[model samples]
Target: MRKFYSTALVGAMASAVLLTAGCGQGLLAGDTGSDEKKNEPIMLGMLIPQSGSEAAIGPYMSNAAQLAVDEINAKGGVLGRTLELKTADDACDPQSAAAGANKLVTAGIHLSIGGYCSGATLPTLPIFAKADIPMIIPAANSQDLVDQKLKNVFLINGTGAQQAGAAAAWMAKDGATKVALMHDNTSYSKDIALRTQALVDEPGGPETAILEAVTPKESDYSANITKVLAKKPDYVYWTGYFQEGGLIARQLRQAGYTGKIMVGDGSVSPKLIEIAGPEAAAGLYATMTQTPDTLKGAENWIADYKKKFGTDPGPYSNQAYDAVRLAAEAVTKAGGTDGEKLISALEAIDGFPMFSGPLKFTPEHTLSTGGFQILVVKDGAFALQDALQ
Candidate 1:
């Protein structure tokens, strides 16, 4: 068990913003606890981007986490205590993430979950290391975070290599001869692309004609399109977010280039179609991160989510929800809020039922059984083409 001390922990816990949207006062219903346990709510900290470019995902992560907390509490609570969620906005920046993590530590939370962006999540690892709080990561699957081998940390989502390996499987199945792998300069994008490039570079794989980098948020990509089109690769992979992926897809299609544009899982959201328009979005393929509807036994969960939030679960919602649910379960299994015990419990988890899939953490603290799937854009929507091994 870890004890909180007064260090330069961010401006007290009160200074941070709460992610619980409405009716936060009654987050858990019908949980009547003993007088001693009533005053103590299990605080679980969530550090994610609530502002900045990746803010669009904040609601999905927080809402899903809150739902898990509510569900756990509704079932008589954990360890005879009600779970309370505390959130801090990392803003997808390293410095801000460290500050936000500090707020969580100062709040004396037992454990923490919710990390959307890799860059933001990387810096906060050391903070949690020092605080000795078990950190359960929902997304932010960069290799760098896992390479550190932090005992206090665990990632529920598939790592970049695992995801890229799946892409390689789909590429081989599709019989792509020549390939062009592209990425925006972000750490997350580069890491996934680099991993995929490694797989494609291996023997029995397609020839990578052009490995290129594109400026994110640029309205025009004619230069890139022209340069890459010269190689006439059979497939082009864009390992970036939805905006740039859609833009480049639109540009390439408009330029009369007939090739499969495979956007990475990070960029395969519905927003991609909105940005690329109907014509360009059609006939495109994208790798997918976990989605609620795609996961097994998640139909009821998705319906409940839609009923509660008025929208379907987004990219990493299942990951976020599972992270919270598993973390809470670990706490219960450990029989207390002990960081080392929680880590042990997490490592020992075997075929745990989650919305996304049955999960068991590998030696690297990542999911042991999972891979990405290729989704083709039909009628301007992501549709399953093939499952990657």
Candidate 2:
């Protein structure tokens, strides 16, 4: 009987060793710790336009991302390990963006949130795609971006086609005929303006009077403004960033073109009002992915953001905030930090509540549905005009 008991004890000990081996393999495979104390912090990367022409809106994005990380850490973080942010500036240029992407790739960061300019984001696409790193773009909205079929890139903000459709509908409703199209010739600006113009020229659509393209860095648009005014358009649509848009607005108003004006998401900056002057910028309409002063269900976020950054959130702040939150959520749901595991978690997300709208990615990693809001400049601030479906 004693011999039989010893054999049974040996069998039990062997089973325990097998179980331990299985658990260790699982932990190693998923980069998870068997105990809370052994868990390592997860690193998240940021690649925003911290300098160059797009710098005015960069800090708000960075601050919003920081706020998301801080809030998640305060709430015990993802899987009990802190989320670490490693930021690299893209400078809103393609070459610089590529360099920043390579730096992040070398540092072993597979998840990142940023890239404000499509021009800058375009060159980095290959870098991230080859490395299989998942990048969540918060604000780059050019239509051609997702056409590359990169498996790992995702966009929280809707595409240029979405915004262009909204803008076309609003202009048609407002009785805009003989519309003039102005763009800065950048991939993003020109794509938005051209797509919007195409929508306007569809069957039963408004007539396009003028289509003008300008250099982004040109200081004086008097020549282009004069050409647009010669068309006598009832509405002038400018698709470009804030600096160029403000310059064009001032030049157009000065050139005595007295029709309604509209700008795209690129011009939705507070500094636009200051640069164009309140009177010149007043009554201008814009379509944006988010508005700082008018986001619904974001009062708490806004207050917290202000408290932390000592400034109000900007246009893409909510989207950037949502990107970080969604990343954390994926990490927690996956129960670990493995890139493939996180990708699966992200794919499984549906109706994840966020400051923007329900968070869900299409098969191609685009937002399931385009989400944006119409905003109008009033009294030196942005007011929500309506929600676009």
Candidate 3:
């Protein structure tokens, strides 16, 4: 990550000012006395899986966000107002996410910094747009999100196209002549699967032997395995969440297919190893941006997280933290919670420090470089393997 100086530091300080300032009068609120309104907290909203197959990840994201909130509040709060976090469960479902989005909007949140699943996040775009709430999405990087072109929406996670290219390139680098791509057919998974297929089909890349979709939440996937094994692929890539991905990994190994196995960012969790069994997951690889364990120069940050939550931070935790800081920065720059002003403030950001690197959104409001790395399941934990420079 790049550190800022001079004017950049001044901009950062301004954002810190916004985070610490007492909440000012909101557009919807009554024009109460300035003194009373100034002491109110600025509400930040989040939506994540709380009671679904992806429930294990909710705390990781939410807690990190709260941690950021706590840090900012400790420093005396934004615009002189303290920051408060309000959360609703999306359960990684589209309908659930839409309802949750509406709940957050009704609650008068100034900004949004949550979205773990792309399919779940997609439907909420219009919901937030209608309410004019700016979203600094920490995860859920489906290319479809960018396609929506919602001015109020921005992503801090790497997009599917970037992950696809990283996956295909890694497979080819491993000398695989035939690669099998699989997904659960969700919008996010399918996008990565299809894009990877296209990349591998390029002139000098590996051949796409099979592109298969399996229904999620099934106990048995022998039929799908049968199809994949028939192609004799030297490499297999699974683009789905941890629940299904873990099962597929174990099943593929149990079926006696010994090819290299890799998973997408959605599947890069410690729970994947648990579900797949340590032995089955030992050689697994993942295409992902840096996670807490895999990130360099994050010891103090991780230590602080463990101290506050009494548990180790995981995937998306850093992103969630960065998202909150980014939101505060924009708020301070914009001088208030006005949607259009916040959008312009975020767009104008340059050289902001993030776990990924210097912050600058492309025209589509995505990172110019996905900053993906190759990770392997070493000793039952995902560890960095290559930077893919």
TM-scores for the candidates: 0.79, 0.75, 0.77
Number of the candidate with higher TM-score, 2 or 3: 3
Off by over 4 Å in 2: 1-38, 49-58, 92-99, 175-178, 184-186, 205-210, 213-233, 241-259, 269-280
Candidate with the greatest lDDT versus the true structure: 3
Per-residue lDDT of model 2, residues 1-389, tens digit only:
11222233234334433544556346655445444243567778888888898888788888999998887787666655788888888999988999999998898774878888888998888887787677788888666678888766888888887788788988888889889999988888888888988999997858789899988888899988888888899899898999988888888888887889999888988888888898898889888776667776567678888898888998689788878877877765665666676778788888666555667898878887546677888999878886664
Clashes (candidate 2): 0
Ranking, lDDT, top scorer first: 3, 1, 2
Q: Number of the top candidate by TM-score?
A: 1
Worst 10 residues of 3 by lDDT: 24-33
Q: Candidate 3 regions off by >4 Å?
A: 1-11, 14-41, 50-56, 91-100, 117-120, 172-177, 184-187, 209-233, 241-259, 269-280, 387-389
What local lDDT does model 1 show for residue 367? 78
Across residues 1-389, which tens digit of lDDT does each residue of candidate 1 receive?
A: 00111111111111211211133224422232232244488889999899999999999999989887887777656666788999999999999999999999999888989788989999999999899899999888888899988998898877887878878778878899998999998888888888888899899868788888999978999999899999999899999999999899899989998878899887877899988899888889888766765554456678878888899888788788877778777765555576786788788887666544557888888877664667889987787776442
Ranked by lDDT, the better of candidates 1 and 2 is 1
RMSD per prediction, one decimal?
Answer: 10.3, 11.5, 5.5
Collision count for each candidate, in order: 0, 0, 17
lDDT accuracy of residue 267 in candidate 1: 85
